[model samples]
Target chain A: MNEQLAFTIEVFLNGLMAGVLYALVALGFVLIYKASGIFNYAQGVMALFAAMTLVGIQNGQVPFAHLINAIFGTDVHKFGWHVHSFAAILLTVIVMIALAWMVQQFVFKHLVGQEPIILFMATIGLAYFLEGVADLMWGSELKALNVCASEGNCLPQGMNVWLEGTTYEALGYGFFIDNLDIVASIVAAVLVAGLVIFAQYTKQGRAMRAVADDHQAALSVGVSLNFIWVLVWSLAGFVALVAGIMWGAKSGVQFSLSLIALKALPVLMLGGFTSIPGAIIGGLIIGVGEKLFEFLIGAPFLGGATENWFAYMLALVFLVFRPQGLFGEKIIERV
Target chain B: MLDDAKQADAQVDNVLEVNNIEVIYNHVILVLKGVSLNVPKGGITALLGGNGAGKTTTLKAISGLLASERGEVTKGSIKYRGQDIQHADPAETVKQGVVQVMEGRHCFEHLTIEENLMTGAYTRTDGNAAIAADLELVYNYFPRLKERRKSQAGYTSGGEQQMCAVGRALMSKPETILLDEPSMGLAPQLVEQIFDIVKSINEQEGVTFLLAEQNTNVALRFAHYGYILESGRVVMDGPAKDLRENQDVKEFYLGMSDEGRKSFRDVRSYRRRKRWLS
Candidate 1:
């Protein structure tokens, strides 16, 4: 294959990898939205905090003798837990769940029947608080993670399979697809499927749907608002933990990991806030589509960083045609 | 005929007894001030009042919706089937077979008619087959809903939506249904049709009804017992027939002249008391 075409394919593959991560973050947003009708601005921070907590529990901070002596009167990094990646992941999930429960019991429960804007602002407050807590708990340093499977080896390492007298490379050029990426993709797909089944078939799923449809009607039917809120938040927290593990494994766990949540906004915008399938499909489209666009057309004109705004632009264009979303129901206004 | 008469007489026992419930909203404003009423096991009891006279508040208190926001039933108890249900959750109340068809029909507009009906059986732990059977029974009462079963409730006309709401409530298999303003915002023809359906529901299905209504003429005509609420107080209480003929009821509600009031009272009271005793 020619160099130009290879580069295009390479960018496309890379975009798909990043898109999967974005979709993971977006899934967290969708779960919380479905149950509580609030767009959680803190979701990104939840992901960051989970990632940081995992790092802190797995590998202790760098030895700074003066600061450690000043703070704990000893070298604290030497007394680190050094837990396994898998165990750390599980522990992080538990911590996230506890945080979720606390958020619902303390913040959300009191804010019931408040205006939507007020609730949204409260999530913004939660985001800042969580970010500060994460920094204080783990320090503001980046920590690298060992891949759950293996480090320094992509899934398919430069294998070419011949088909019909032509040799087609299994992996793209210049950017080898890591087995970890493939695993992340598979995990994301499985999570999405599980969430879909839970939302459709389970009794709690029906209650969640009822709550999403109308809060007053759900309350009238005797659905506990506080319980459902906590359930959804915990579910969202699990999603954050999963996303944190994958992203932390791929790119070092740090405060910047929270920035990934910003990408999910456009995903939500394109898919509509209430849809689960919308999040998955919209994620894949943004992932695969933007990379290809950036590699081929973007380099020729707009230069680089096309992937940054590609999803938002596509979503904006789509909004002009279908304002609610590709999958969103059209809202009718009654005077 | 004798057995049926005996059964009817036994069923006349009070199914619901409300004893002096006082409801305060936002902890200060008293909506229901020591109000009490009783509904028999197998007929209509009309709660008649003007707007804001606590008719809707009384119905809501029974359903558990009004109590969610700390709207304390300060002074009395509500007995359903001889058990205190004043503090029961809405779902528990529904499961106990006392379903409230809320005012304005509160149909789940985004849901299909069939889905709306399914929600009524939300608290039922019965098998899907039993639920399906109940659905058929509900559709039999309001066939129009069955025809538009797959259609979203938002698209249905006002009268059809009312039918769907009532039909959905019936899907729960409640022994007693509380209806709040079932006649509101409908044409006179549709109102007559709804009242006729309510009568059939009571007569044929043996379901009891406590209906709150503003149309005093029609309410008194259809009800077996009636209470006239004026400014959150029951000013007059008697059998429906007696209330229809009472001088006070005629002047305040029936729009009858005062010249005929004095002569009607004794005859009306005696006839009403005789019907009650029989």
Candidate 2:
């Protein structure tokens, strides 16, 4: 193998790693979109809030710690709750679910029957509001999260078997892979598979599909729209929590985690807004295609950071060919 | 009409009674103006009218769909089984055994035929076993629906969709079924078939029916009683047999000319006077 080929392989693997993270965020988008027509622009912020809440509860923050102790009547700090990572994750998930319920019951319930664009704008407002609430709760400080894997640390780097017998060694270039990248890949694949099965086989999943098809029809059939909304939002919150943990472990949890959600917009556009499998495949394509393009075509002309626009450009190309999306149903209009 | 009203008032077993109801749309335009009717138990009643003549509006008002929105029974009351249900929700209406097979056969297009049938049983608290039994009954009435049970409603033909719609309403096991334009847009053969199934459903299930239809001839043939609406008001109403034999109805609706009416009257009186002489 040549130096060029080895570098190309490295870029491709890196793209796959990034795609996994994008898939997680995109999952959240798809979940909310399935149950309610609103595109939840606040999904990224929900992840940020969940991560911040986890840190706050672990650190014994003024209000959260006081409130928890007052309600449960147990001194969390004295009981040594801060030392338990699993407990913190569980508590953060619960708080996120409660927040989801509140959001549906108060904000969304009032805004029902509004136009989809108006609802989208409302979600944007929710995003900003949630970001503010998170900052107030956790002071916008950076925090570290432990990996959920029992291995206790990211996967270690090892020698590539394909590159072992290659002459690329002469150029000090070889296919490199990180332990954390490999684990992230595995986790992403598992999550995607789990979600696919859940949506396909479960009763709640069927209700979600029905609601996505026609909300008014679903309501007429007695599929409690409010309850489904809260359920989907909480499910999205769980996805966000997982995304937060993984991203927090990789880059540390901060406001920047919210920025990662912007990546999912192009993912949604490329895959079509309402598709679950489309999100996963789109994430992978955006992930690997961008990195390879950046290395092969982009580096020679526009320099680095070409990966940032590569997904959007590919998505733009797809829109021209199949406007509804790769997996989306074509919309027909009748007079 | 006042004497008929007095007679209906004396009857205690009225299935549904609509008294001088007014439905206004968008708080401005009146759709149903002082509309009133009564359906007797175990009989088919027809609401006949031309397009946009408040026929469909009346059906929706009784089914609780219109009452929830821009429609208000401002002037009168609706009693179903002696219960005031003017303000009832659709779910509550279904619970009270009143189901409407709405205009256009509003089947859930994306759902499977079987799933659409299950939705009709939404208000039922019975377990899966009873629902399955009802499903079998619906399938028996519309065998075409049974054949396409796993197919999405959108893929079904229009007549088949109508069957699924009516079948779904029956799955709820309602005492009264309101069908709006079940014969609309269907082939002539399918129209006859649908009306026949409706008649059987009435006879076998003892289900009271209030059907709104544009085809006055077919509606009168199947209905036990009928109301003829012209421009949002009932112009004439009586037993279906009497309406079929009425001379005014023949001239205006049945396409009978003056010569045909005169000959028919002469033949009828000649037969009567001959019988008196004998």
Candidate 3:
């Protein structure tokens, strides 16, 4: 009931919400890495591209409008029509799937059986390439992703009045919590649950795990490496879309949106690259740790902005103590 | 009557035929120089050789696993069921009923034993019921696998891991299995047990086996046919019985001769006396 305690609870809650967002992005990295041993440097750019495509589709903006105008000397941009948010999302998903296929077919197919470092480097090139393509398609402008705003059921933003009023009545001080954060937490929970079921129950899921364990053994058992790799890429794309939606809705879709992936790096180091549960828990730990640190010491003693580097510092500590992350599979060596 | 049936089998078309295949690694190191062999249906055929003698290369070529390692069958052809398959994908080869249980017991280390076996049936379109039935059949052959079915494969003993690898291959219901060095790194008793299972799998299931082994004594005992390889070439091949009784094989491989148990140092003068090489 103390005023400080209530505010601390509020900060802790916000940190948890932010952690959920980080885990969402980190989930994409874990999916591709676990399946192919490729770190997928383009995961952030994937989120950026997915968000950009969603906005372009929703507003019925012409793709490559700038390029078209430059070539034809005509000012043409929009189709003069609006698409439903749900339809836009569906189309975006289709586009993401197509992108996944092309990435596998054109880029990674030739790089099969290459060293992990080579694969990682290829993803870096892919990230920059995809970013340029998305920029050209959408014209590199910030777009507000209202997400069903046209339908009058837009993604809620700002503090929840109900939670604030109830907390004020009960504890003599209101707790501030964003409705968007609540939604993101719920989405993340559902996404994680769906992924776990898909991985643990399906036939293709079994093959995915088999490929992750040993590519040679999986191929010998008749599991197609190309198919599984594409499947994994598609899954990662789907995760990226979900993450992009949540983050974009919170702070209008922009190039800065992709920078959230940098935040996910520390979370992965803490959680372990190959673990799903590790990502979620690691995100939560990082979320709470950074927020609490900023509140207690960062703002007062370190003059604020400690949240920017607190997660990385904490992750570095974890890396030193547990190089495998909190839940990475231990390497087994036969002596 | 049995001898007549055996003679008829010898005349029948082979399930797998490799004709003078030359394997080059990284396009430079020639690992298999014109190696050739045949695997008859429902028989254990042993490819025998010392280390680096191209035993594993021959099996990988048959299974189409060489491509992953940058090894190419450049000079000759490999035919499975009389279809040319030198350039086929390993998964395609598996789908066509030929599977390779890779050397060194490459079990899916993180998966449970049952899950690891189930992965072998990844290409089967016969539904889970058939897969379950095959799983039970595999369990019957390797009961230890069934007991450790819930345990992570990497944690199981080496013998159990070998059994799991073989049992995993069986779950695919393969018509022909290219087994590479199943006896490697195991105790003598465990080696005998695995060989026994391979023999039974061949007899009861009527599955064809092309096994590569360094233990010439045991491979000769169980194999119906044998090909002895030396430095990327098949030096000699015959019925398993003949290879077991051949004079050079006795001195070099089985560690016995007419003079009885002479060390390699004592037999150095006879090194160039290999009649097949000569």
What C-alpha lDDT values do all the predictions have? 0.79, 0.78, 0.89
Candidate 2 achieves a global lDDT of 0.78
Instruction: Find the candidate with the highest TM-score and give its number.
Output: 3
Predicted candidate 2 versus true structure: per-residue lDDT over A1-335, tens digit per residue:
57677777778878888888887899899888867888999989987888777767665565444456668997643333343566777888899889989999879887777788999999999999999888766666687755443323232333333222323333567556655566667877887788777765555666666677666555444456677888889889988988887787778889989987888988888778778877877787788888888888898988778977888888889888877676664452222
In terms of docking quality, model 2 is: incorrect
Highest-lDDT candidate:
3
How far in Å is the alpha carbon of A144 misplaced in model 1? 3.4
- TM-score, predicted candidate 2 vs. hidden true structure: 0.80
The most accurate candidate by DockQ is 3
Q: What is the C-alpha RMSD of each candidate to the true structure, in Å?
A: 6.9, 8.0, 2.6
Model with the higher DockQ, candidate 2 or 3:
3
How well does each candidate superpose onto the true structure, as a TM-score?
0.79, 0.80, 0.95
**Residue B258, candidate 3: C-alpha displacement in angstroms:** 2.1
Per-model TM-score (chain A alone): 0.85, 0.84, 0.94
What residue pairs are clashing in model 1? A155-A178, A155-A179
Instruction: Give Cα distance to truth, residue B99, candidate 1, Å.
Output: 2.6
